[model samples]
Target: MITAQKREESLQDVPIAVSAFSGAALERAQIENPQDIQFSIPNAVLVGNDRFTLRGIGNNAISSTADNGTQTFFNGATVALSPQDEFYDLERVEVLRGPQGTLYGRNTTGGAVNVITKRPTSQLEGFAFGQAGNFDSVKLQGAINLPMGERVRQRFAGYWLKRDGYTENLATGNGIDGREQFGVRSTTEVDLPWAVTGRLTLQYFEEDSSRARETKRLCKAIAVLGCSPNELGFDSPNTSAVIMQTLLRSPIFTGIFPPGGDIYAGAPNPQDLRKIAADYDPKTEGENFIGVLDLSKTLGSLTFTSLTSYSEGKSKASTDWDNADLPFRFLRPITYQLGPDRQVTTDRLLTIDQFTSRSRTWSQELRLVSDNDGLFNYTAGAFFFDSKGRSRFEIWHPAIEFFTRAIGLPAASQHVDNDTPYSRTKAWALFGESYFQVTDATKLTVGLRYTDEEKAIRTRSIVLAAPTPYVVAERDWQEWTGKVSLDHRLDLSFTDETLLYASVARGYKGGGLNPGNAVDPDFEPETVMAYEVGAKNQLLGRALQANLAAFYYDYTDLQLGQRIGANAVTANADAKIWGLEGEFLWRPTENWLFDSNLSYLNTEIGEFLTIDAANPAQSLTTRTPAVPVNLAGNELPYAPAFKVKIGGQYSFGVGDWTGTLRADLTWQDEFYAREFNTPNDRIDGWALADLQARLVRDDGRLELQAFVKNVTAEDNIVSSIIEDALIGSYRNVRLLEPRTFGASILVRY
Candidate 1:
């Protein structure tokens, strides 16, 4: 049970735009992460790559050094790595938009994504459930409590999920996408008699899915319509000279396929396009661990709480969907056939390591809560954190392969067997928040934080070409970011649940270094200033409660990922982005709820100067990409048009059985582009309806549930864009999944 005081106060009564979704709410929504089909909340748009513009402020980049748009935190521990594989053990999710530099810290010139885990409760009860659905999907989840002693207890839990891959009807008649997952969590608590409590938790999650990180194109050149080998995808050009001409205005050409096709047909198949398209091999895996400790005690007039945590994770995978057939321009063409068609038609064939990454993080935080003075309450804290990450990249090219333009032009630039080592960074900080009750029903909030950060990057690269074809690069960097907020409680005669607040804060994102020739070790930081105002209160005789907020964010020296010289290296440029975002939720009746959100943004580059003004930075115009302009002023990449949702549930009890049925409808206005710098990165808004039914025992402790998601197979692109100069990813097609049904059984002891 929660107290009136706790309910009256928010976790942060600042004016910044933010929303928190609890474990119960998440479970009821059947959502795994922001990638779910629904994109209405906070007027945000989310894509599979994890790029989200809560209010249209973030975008994904091919550059390893680019801002990830959104930074994610798990159990209060910040995770700054490949976010695609970071979802698990979430007890709640917090979406804080605009700039959060003052509190959340860097790389958040846009915003932050936070996931909080559930802690062990003092009880001997537990629940277990199993669910199965379409696509041969099955999942099981359970939680258990064990008593350790009169003053101590333990909590343990685990979950498993298995499903067939979602990809295709194989020409070879086999499942292409299959998956498996297993996870476990344990918690121990020790109650001390000295008014101090201690708790410890250990967690591990491991999964091996048959899904590869990369997707293969299904179209193959069969030559059934008298299609020339070059027309269908051969000519297999070498790229060394082609890239040189791209900016030099030389007569270097790209996009020539081999004599037979774009991809080599393997073995007896004789270098054919059909075989390459069908040769895709898909598989993926992930492993993660987390440890936590919480201790608290009341000392004289101050209540002290300490939280310590550490986490480690590793992931690796492979994809085989004919990525080798990519366009020649992107490949830097020039190649020849040393063997028959399947023997070596093009350099596009990729033996991708897919991707691999490892990370470690540790943090300690201490907080002091002022003794309640009857008229006011407040809190303060000191925090320290350290984090490290390592990753590897591999690209392949063929000597006679078409991508090298037949391999005879200047130096060979394709068929690279390359690898990049891990990059590491660390940080420490102190922060505090206090609320002063100025009057019987009026209160004010003040927050502040100071952080010191240090970062290092280590990388090793080896060239696949002749002579001395190997080189290595290494570097390091650091910075600081900080936050403040104010809140007010309304003096109402009829209803006392009310609050109005506003705030201003700074946000940051770290800089990085890449291996290309023009590698700039001195990448600058991304920063932002956030402003917000909002109202929180209950209305209509307490039958309804609402939270509304509006915010504006100004971004500066935005980090722009750029390609350098002949080596195809990378560097960070300067840009600017700014926007306005908002959200609101309302419950008008016992059986009805309504909510909505919207946002608008403007982004542009103050100056366009390639980070590497020298070296291969010859044609500034050739490199003046629309990434800054493409994404700026447009609704943030992931910010959708306005959104609204209405849901209703009716429940009744009869004899030994009670059941509740619910229906929800959600809608969104058209939103931004999915691809960058293309004329058609636009997606019209859409609406969807879903249903849920729950049957339970008279006591309501045991129950069964059924649900369906995305009832309508809306034929719409989440966002569309044309990847220029290259044939691939021309139109990233994202569609809502058709429909699926699943049921869950729950029990209480």
Candidate 2:
């Protein structure tokens, strides 16, 4: 059973494409975080830490006012911040593919993910689980249920996790990308006098750990002039020449350059993928709090539901931007003369970047749903959401400050600081859906939604002796999105059950402000029209299950981010995507089970011309005759052409216990990380394998398991990004986690 339609229904009966995982299934797979869920789903991938893509559609821009194309919900309420520690004590997770605009509203052009937690039950029971692994990893998780009275119930759950980092810092002999976090949740349920029920939940999470290390992959000296083989032995683009020329033109450095010199003459390029050299070992910390209230009542054949939620969070991080030893000496003329008789001196500097952000969000939803027993049923709802946040970003060059002061130059030339003092989003929507049973074997469903959203932000840059003027920008967008589907059941002799369905749906993401960009302060909203056909069947007396789906999407006004000097702006583009997916489960015997999933995707960008920010010839300090690069027919980022997953499990009796053995293998094709699809942005295909063995008491009171992940020890690059010319011409690369083995035990009361 699942809630894909905002109501309880059989998974095979729903016409939409959705993948659901139960808590038991999650534990069996040893899935500890939300990112791990993607390996089991078809046509779904996770880029970086927070960027999630489904069927080649996802948000690539990093802006204060922009929203994600794929949205996440916790217990029917939208989660403004990433819930890194909420995977514990979950009832189930549902991933709905394609557009869910009618019921989910905005920011779901790619899809919607629903994370439902276990509710309070009228039972006095509890369980505890513990695990230990390599890298000094330790974890503890447990939950307790209490029956306060005949009409009251309470539940509490929490988890603690700590592990050493995987990446080694050669400069400090320390680890990076470590994990240290803890979270707790409390829920209460009460029965009201007016035939109503109410539930309240409170959750808190905190984390303090070493930040992820970014490996610097710099370009070769010859590559600075054009696209050539870089240190990674790939023809990659860089901005070395543009940055050098910009510094040369600045008045403050009139005579600091030699006849022909390279600024990145001594930059370090580490060869090991899991090792980095940096002068600074940064730390990242954050805390979040969330509260939700739900009330429901049934009157005749209709049910009324109300949900309210509020959340607040703050985070801070500091990093060594250069990823190398500082104070690199360079020869400069002291008397403003180009002759050999002039005195030469060396100057050095270090680069550091710091960021702090705080945000609060609240939302309310009221809905009415009718019973599903009748031939005609309907669902209607209204939603309101509001969020406000502030962020401060600073890039410091301490040596430049001293140099500028000695030369009597402005303080603004020494560093760059940008502060978004205020950023806000307000949105409201009205939606409705209806179902009609055309006959005993046929059904028609339709849904519609209207959304109105507005966003505003104020930015202040170069907060020094002479700070730049504050830029305030605001934009409003309205859109209409909906879905229509028809499904029919066929009575065949060989198949015990069979269903076929087709749907046409539309999705929209609101436009947003650019904060400091006055000339292009806003971007247009993005929209997608999706067409799909699918089938679900059961055979061999319900022992075999097979599902297949094919879809095509028409995407327009796709939003992308670009950097101009120290500022970022948004742009619009178009694209098309088509894919086929299949899932199968077979149980040939009572003690054996097998499953497999396959996906094939094809994506192409529509004809459009835009600036190539990574090109060495492009200027970053000023907006001039912009160089145009056509991106027609280019494949979308993270959209691998093929993906396959296969797994099997076997169970047998062991004295007074049950023993089970399971193994899984997954493979993914190569894909790019940017729209340009340059060699530097490509990530090679990789395969991973995992194995597990478990033993449980016949009464289920105790359980023990041993598991190993990434048995092949594949070193795959999960994500990468090219830095701006001003920040140095290089790429920041992030790799997948290394192989790990662990053992766990669970005890139930």
Candidate 3:
């Protein structure tokens, strides 16, 4: 039986540009995190900093303020609005592209990602499974669906994953990247007569891992004289800068060694690095509480739905690596916590940390979905929200000589910051669509939305080393956004599922301050007028379905990450992106199934105000190039250019026994950075394969299955980094999990 649902009412009727992946598809692919979605979903890209850019809307460098170009929402509430929450048990993921300010009511200037968790189903069932694999990797998962009779029901699910490091730490005997995650999510639902539903969900995650491996810097081999590698040495207090130059995978980086590279001067391997190391390491913990009360009723011509939700979360994240050399222009003393200035003979480099916010939010939405069956269909909604958040960071460079000598420098330096504000955002919108009767072969959709917002901020600063003590300030701002789009279908004679569409949507992304020492008025919000054309179709007796869309995004105020002197700033740049995304699935011959997805994005910033490569580590050849001049024009990171997935499964019965075999492989093209500035930074894409076999009993009595991932032990990095060679796990590259195999079983009475 094909119990899976292929299409949703939202897909067939909503005028908004969007796409979604069912939890079934996610489970089949063993996608544990949001990044894993990149393989099957199109356009959606996950870059180096765990940042997301839908249709190229977000910036790679994220900050403490809303100035970021992209925003993320969970269950109608904003998650990325602050970064207080983490990815947890999700039932459905919706990616809405364009300005959704009308409904989302938060920082949704660009678009929003809605993660809806599965409510308690009125059923009683539960299952537990465990998997063990190579490299001491193990995963255990369980879920229970319970109906407490009367008016109550609940669903609980959890998983724990522990794995050894993926990258080798030459400095320590152990590998780098070792990690462990334990999380549980519970949802309770109360059903009442007269159309009212109350839901309470609590999710907790405690993840301890050695993350953010350091990067190895590359120096210019101008000559064997002063600035060469020998100037620095690799021993005791240091290593000779000379011999270290030979360790580079590509000798070419030496040629572009700009002036900043001089900071390493006579030091060996002036770059900071991340490696596999044995250290008590840094740990991260996070949690979320999402509460909702929903009320809905249907009248003759209208359906009214009211939703109110409150969410809260707190998180702490930190990572350590080997750092005997100075990482910044201002050399501070390095320490386990931070010494004045000397090589603290500790396990890892700096034991730094951050304690901040994310999920403090409350929202209310009232929506009406028209029940009229006339020639047009529509939906309208009103939303409101408010939030508060703060973050802290501490950094120490134990190896800097000025600090080791305790010359004039202080011990460890730290800063605590925050952005607390109250906002009133409103959106008014209407959408209408109709199946043209005249042509009987066409469908049309027209929708428009307008939004207004009021934003304010209170900044907090605490610096231990500064004599001026704590710094406090305040700021306020506001903006308005609008969007309009149209779609038409041409598959009247074929299938309603097979249609063509061309739409122009105006997207808005609000901007704000940089937080850590921002002096500017504020970054400007972004606006994009995107023109897209696409096709949705099915073939061969409706057993196959596909959707393809190509878009040209013209952006004003494109967001880019840069280092100007010691301050990290975000500015509006002008640029554009053109891309293609498509997906297809074929289940021909009942017993076999094949599926594939392809995506290509050519994105770049045309006019950047200036190129301030002043981050102690790098210096682009030009000093602040002209805005809109195209920086590399490379495929956005986290988004591979091309991807394909092919798989098939067969099932048969022998007497009273049933068995099945399924296998899938994912492949992508070789992807590298536009420029090489660090080690453990590039990857030539490779294929990952998985196989599964199951034994089942016809009575729904018992079942068992075996599975494996990365059957080829492929070593790859899904993220990029600017790593120096001396540190561990600080290499900048976030490695993909290596090969592993495991099995699972289930029993139901």
What local lDDT score does residue 656 receive in model 3, on the 0 to 100 scale?
Answer: 78
> For model 2, how does the per-residue alpha-carbon lDDT over 77-144 read when each residue is reduced to its tens digit?
88764545648889998888888999998989989888888999999998999999988889999999
Looking at model 2, residue 203 earns an lDDT score of 91
Local accuracy of candidate 3 as per-residue lDDT tens digits, 662-722: 7877776555432222222245676878788877888856777787877787765555543
Q: TM-score rank, highest first?
A: 2, 1, 3
Top TM-score model: 2
- Ordered list by lDDT, greatest first: 2, 1, 3
Model 3: per-residue Cα lDDT at residue 325: 35
The prediction achieving the highest lDDT against the true structure is 2
Lowest summed lDDT window (length 10), candidate 3: 1-10
Q: Compare candidates 1 and 2 on TM-score and give the better one.
A: 2
Candidate 1 vs. true structure, TM-score: 0.78
Each prediction's whole-model lDDT (CA): 0.54, 0.80, 0.52
How many steric overlaps are in each model, in order? 72, 0, 67
Candidate 2 wrongly placed segments (more than 4 Å): 81-83, 213-267, 326-348, 399-413, 463-466, 621-624
How close is every model to the real structure, measured as TM-score? 0.78, 0.92, 0.77
